[model samples]
Target: MQDQPLDASDFELIEDTLLKYGDDHSVLNASELDGYFTALVSSPVQVDIAEWFPAIWGGQNPDWQSPDEGKQFIELSVRHINALATQLAMHAQAFKPRFEQTEHHAQPLTLAEEWCFGYLRGVAVGNWPELPTPLAAQLQAIAFCAEQDNFEPPADLDVAQHRQQIEAIEAAAHALHDHWVAQR
Candidate 1:
């Protein structure tokens, strides 16, 4: 799909999750909530990866082979993040025309983009192949935030609350993707 997708209730869950955690200091304190948080933060991505993957570069992070190794890792991560941001923007912008639905619709995400991101999440993490670790990790966050659900929205949920929840999740996914782009 070319746009974001979601049922009413899926939106509610996402929003609640975000609203639950958005204000949490931990969410903003760290670049990521998963792997590489501790290890990579202290070292460059390449050095960290090589150190972690001894066969690749032979204990590089601890005793680097070159003075430029750390810089190289930073540059590489930056490139990767930049590229991911462009790709994300392409997909997100691709939704604007389609998701607007009404001339005055505000910050709406389309069903297509949601499906695209969800599908992307599956491909990135679902044992399809060995993909880049950082990208996969970030996609997991997006999936967690924007994930669609099959259940119905609760009976007690008001329409405005549902819409706000959807917007919140969509915003979170977008922000997390932006964080990925910004991290390196």
Candidate 2:
């Protein structure tokens, strides 16, 4: 299969549709959606898409007025996720973690936080073993991103510092992917 990333518009459409149909309690925003997909594909255990879809989508197929569009969304998502898995597997160090860009009034930190939440969910589903010490420390850093909103940023953490944290999280993701692949 071709490994091209999904078009930005297509990604937005799928994310928007899922959000419209998802449970109110759902935390799987657009960035999380990608993270969840990556986790499913990288999972050591085989995951059945049929079962996984509903679970990820708040336990129901999206209530699309146009079934064809819903089907298209699924197809596109599967393809995009497959491409991600391919990249992670074949070129892990080169894998660039995808995150939602800050837009409108949204903060860049929010994107990182949401992406980390989704990524952690994915890692949970994969049932990864306890990571080695250095990797675990990196994972802890990523986990901290999930709590960004709850805690005030340190006075020393300026824009560049925040960006560094995000970059570290991305690097951590690559390391996590490598750890999983090595286990297989």
lDDT of 2 by residue, 88-165 (tens): 888666566677665322444434776777777766666667878998898898789867633445545476676788
Could you tell me how far off, in angstroms, the CA of residue 59 lies in candidate 2 after the best superposition? 2.9
Which residue runs does candidate 1 get wrong by more than 4 Å? 1-87, 90-148
For residue 174, model 2's alpha carbon misses the true position, in angstroms, by 0.6
lDDT of each: 0.35, 0.71
TM-score of 2: 0.81
lDDT comparing candidate 2 with the true structure: 0.71
